[model samples]
Target: MMDPHDDVELSDLEDDAFIPSTSRAKSLKGKSPNRFLRWLPPRMRAFLENMSRIRLVIITVIVFILLLVFISYWNGRLKDVSIPKQSLALSKELARNLSNTAIPEYVLTYAPLVFLDSEDEFYPSDMAAHVSNAHPTMNFNPVKDAPEGLTLDNLNDLNDLGGDSIYLTSTTLLTNLPNYLHGQKPDKKTLQTENAVSCVIALANKEDGILDAFYIYFYTFNDGPRALGHQVGNHLGDWEHNMIRFKNGEPQAIWYSQHEYGAAFTYDAVNKIGKRPIGFSAKGSHANYAVSGAHDLHELDDEIPAHIVFDQTSQGPLWDPTLSAYYYTYSSTNNKFEPANDKTPVNYLYFEGQWGDQEYLDGVEGQEEFHGFHKWTSGPQGPIFKHLDRKDVCLPRDGGCIIKESL
Candidate 1:
């Protein structure tokens, strides 16, 4: 019967005083902390709400680990598809540009036709593709201020940055056996086509119209032979070669690289497919030889027992390296490589570094040493260290160049 506004205010105050402060606080705490949980099922929401902080963190970490594993698996698959295309493109470009150069006709005519073993998995690799897939490193650590995207054209830049200590470390783990590591398989139909694998030909003009032609072959992975039930001497990169000594445009002698040492023979002594010499690449090691059979490594060093360490070779698929190759003239005087085509990359030739990963320690994962022998060893240095400018047919370290009369 009094003022209506006064009556309403008195009723609101009475209602608030009826509820205790503790009871109101308890009601607020009972509500879901996260509004998103409202969309979840009742049982699931309750379980998550009751989970301890430590349990929640452990579950989160497991989920994150699973996600990372899924991403890595797919990433390797993507590389398998992309690497081949990249290699093919580089092969085609090198072949196309080769036409512009004035490479001697005899160089191609006498080039060694390599025979890869029938059971061999690894094949000839492309240098440009190799450089593209690797990064410069020093002592297993990334080189500081190194080139962002290293390529064959600028490979020599690393010589200044890290010099002999630099390593062109592969991006993919060597243990993974990536497709690129298998390299370019020779196709009979594609041997003469743009799809052919590329090789390196470095010519050294000697005194009195003498020409020493070096045919270098690259492989992404070197499969070491099993010794005493353990794989020993395995490495990430391989460089095998053959050097032909010619006088007055005629072949005189040929040399085949095998491990640290190689064999040399008169040009007429080796088997020939027409004017081209035939070389057999060892089953897995890719050591070039003039004939097929078991090649005794002890022949180079008398200290090792004969047949204890040997390479097996056979006549398998023929690989014509001349079909696709990079030609260059090496000047021993200045120790420089001059590419036939201006577009050909020569910087890589000057690189004085290892082409693969350094040797792993015994305690490192997947690496071991048995009876003073390591399962894995350091990769071979680039062709530059192969005595490219040597005056004799054999490497300078060989003391005297032994020219074998037969295989």
Candidate 2:
């Protein structure tokens, strides 16, 4: 016999050898949940994983739309408001009618004054330092003897004598003009100029009799840098003003502008130690602070941590309030101070020119960039019309007097 059972066992062994070892091994399971998802319940993990990413995108879009609408509402407010036209007309008429009269001596004797650096020799300390360092040979004040033939008639021609600009201190003449000029022309290197700074008188009043309020405005011009320190963009002409408000012939408030907006100090608010308001014009910025170190963007410290502009010395120019000043109605048609028969100088306001050398771009190394785009480069727009009609008077809306009316 061939042994059929043995042959059957042999056939089974051959079949097992032909099968791969991998096939005999157990099958591997799928990957487990990530570490983050492992902490959640299995059901919760599944729910989160099923969320549509599209929903996130939709929510983001909705939030952006809401933000856009919020911005639009605020921007619209700036454009919607209209200036009161009747007020403007009233102011113009008031300016023209008062042209003939002089600023009352009593009003000038009592009103407070806002002091500025004299265009010539009497510069603030910082400016004096710069002038001494930069132009050592040049005499800041060169006149000892007052030049004759200087008048409002020939005042506009002051620049013809090498003066960079003129200030109208009064419609008449400044008797003290000689004091502000160069010292007797003793030096050949001195800054050459005939100081012909003048002034115009105007009184803004609400009515003819028993005046409720009056305004006295002054004008000045600067030949260079215009600001305190050696800031660039020094210009040829700068016109600035200080306005005083009188109620019942008493000085009620003083307005000293820095750039466009300034502080309005009530008669009681300022330090009466000097018998007038004491204001400090910042060293370089020239923004007048009610007190030393009190400065802000609009000269209002409504925001905390205001921009504190420091003066070179806490003790600065102190002006005499009792000094004579005037008020005048403006005649817009003739560009004249009221009382047109009074000789008016050439309408220097009409000729707009660059007040100084071109704006400077190069700043000293390791210092803030002093580009030419400063206010000095624009030259000063002489005392423009400001309204005393409302305590909230604002010219160009964002600027000018912002004193809230006492209701």
Candidate 3:
């Protein structure tokens, strides 16, 4: 989760929080008939002389008090739904369940489809985590203990295919987690920020009480800090024993990312393939996943991203485009690369200076020439971007992919 409120972390940001001139309770305390007249400006005080009768003034003060209570009551409930508290038993139970059940479609729906360098489709959260760092601890460095059953994956053979095992993201559970646990809600601030301006300060009379009871108020926009969200959520990926279960209900391979595998004290972002995913477009950005993991997703020569940071961290994705083998090329003839020459990140057929010339790619499905001018002669994505930003986009919630009977 990237920080959605305002890009960048609190430490890096300049303080711009809305601070009231005076506390609401203090300002509204014990108003007397003469008090109003004395405190108000001269012209206003003169006009209020008649209305300052004891009973009228007392009623006005009471009405103001009631409004505050109402605001606090309603706002408190919203906070409960967003950030819920995690139970040790529940976290362990969930980790074990993940090791057995075939993650449901509802769960799959929660994965985040990130914008690749190629501007293509997406991957699940767990898978994204694997690609990002190949470890869950990269996500949970703060936690000191591990839950049961999550210790290892016994379902599949995870000997790297001469490379590394791919961990999948699990926004699916995030999307559907609250359903399994009742009485849990989002953190308090999460809800207040959404409606704070419209709400009155009097509602804060019980602000301390609301904070204590409310669980979901920690507001969540699409982009928020993974650390904050993961902390309260008991992100299972970081546990030492976190295991991968197969579709048929058996623990597969033990899963962890490069960070967890390396065992370092400080987190290394450069080696980390995971981060708050940046999409090519969203509602405020663009409404689409550009293409699948490819080389041309970003503007050419963009060494570092220059967009807003949710927590103001210098960021990168689970994958890097600079290491890929493709370039965003265009010719007067729009030559679309299909079945994406996945062998390498890009293909030379489109760049050999022969694509636009009707020699070979003249009648390609994606290449239509208008007066022999090139429009978009690169990879075109499928009808729908497979992943959304919020879910499986960053980690592999589905766990490892495989099956085996229990010994």
Candidate 4:
């Protein structure tokens, strides 16, 4: 006979064998910002405070601000890069027969001069080593009757005219123009043409005999080790420098350092090659002469330091009193030009000499001397270097060179 108890046991075993393995779903546990601290011992809370959300928020804000600043800097630089082509095109389009009257008379008159501070007593021993150095070929004896009322301090009066883009509108002649042709960035390279920007020249509305006007020009170019002049002339102790502006309106000449040049750098070859001996400034040195000898000043040629460019920004070109003393301005108009107007000279020279390269006194040999320049090596000269290397008047800006108020 079959035992009922044995059957029951057999049934229990069968049931156990039939049961299928199933996995139960587990609910997820997300951490709450506050819930996390509850489980920690009170002692750990102090250390945990260091990692609080508030600290994280602070760090995030700081990082965000830094990012914004960096973005602004690059944005301005990139915008500047596009400026040259547009600026040059604008000037070229407006300028008819560029060689003639279109160049403005003041540019020919009172040609800006760039001179070495013959007064500079200090120079690197190595830089002092090689070839004899060059200096300005002109004199910079400030204008005597310069409106008697005009001063570099009144620049802000024009800020209301055009938010920093009105300075280039004047048609009157300028005796001196800045030599910001070669700047650190692509924008600077075209500075003389369009890349260079001039804001409105503001004046306090002259009433009596005194004039209260200011001019500002900003040369937005790159500065420091890796720039063109610095890279090529590093062995020569050259550096990348530039000119910033605060040009003014008021239609007239500002100042003049006598209308003459010297012979310190006016070598024989300079005169023999061309009648109008135009000179160009070194990218970094802003030296008055065109030749970029040897000796890199910043060792910028080998490599641009990784830390050279950090988060920085430019608020357009204007006179920051904090950065103004080192700057200067130039202005011009067409009526000032005389027929034999070597008086109003333009500092720019085309590589091939087509753009007024041959402009001179009709038949005068002195005119043939073309102001003592060689077309192949033409460099613009200006007045900013009047006190070159002077601890006082020189540009406080980092650019080793600042174009003198040239043509």
Which candidate comes out best when scored by lDDT?
A: 1
Q: Which of the predicted structures, 1 or 4, would earn the higher lDDT when compared with the native?
A: 1
**Per-residue lDDT over 99-152 for candidate 3, one digit per residue giving the tens place of the 0 to 100 score:** 433222221111111221122112111211211222222121211231222211
Clashes of each: 0, 32, 110, 74
Which 10 residues in a row give candidate 3 its minimum summed lDDT? 211-220
The lDDT per prediction is 0.77, 0.38, 0.23, 0.26
Pairs of residues clashing in candidate 1: none
| Residue-wise C-alpha lDDT for candidate 2, range 1-407, written one tens digit per residue | 76756546766778778854664443322345667987999899888766645678888999999998776545322122221354334334544554445545444444343333322233321111111111101022222332343432333343443343322222211222323222211111221111222233445554433222233222222322222343332332233334556667766666655555555666666643434445444443344445443233423434312343223213333332121222445543454545324543434333222222233223523122223234333234233333434343233345465553220
lDDT value, residue 282 of candidate 3: 21
Q: Could you give the candidate ranking by TM-score, starting with the highest?
A: 1, 2, 4, 3
Instruction: Estimate the TM-score for candidate 4.
Output: 0.22
Q: What is the alpha-carbon lDDT of model 3 when measured against the actual structure? A: 0.23
- Model 4, span 177-216: residue lDDT tens: 1222222221232333122122212222222332322222
Go through the candidates in order and give the C-alpha RMSD of each one to the true structure.
Answer: 21.7, 18.3, 29.0, 23.6
The positional error of residue 299 in candidate 3, measured at the CA in angstroms, is 38
TM-score of every candidate: 0.73, 0.43, 0.16, 0.22
Residues 265-335, model 1: lDDT tens digits: 99998878667788889977899888776677678667655667777776666777766677888888888
Q: After superposing candidate 4, which stretches have Cα over 4 Å from the reference?
A: 1-40, 46-50, 80-385, 388-407
How high is the lDDT of residue 13 in model 3? 49
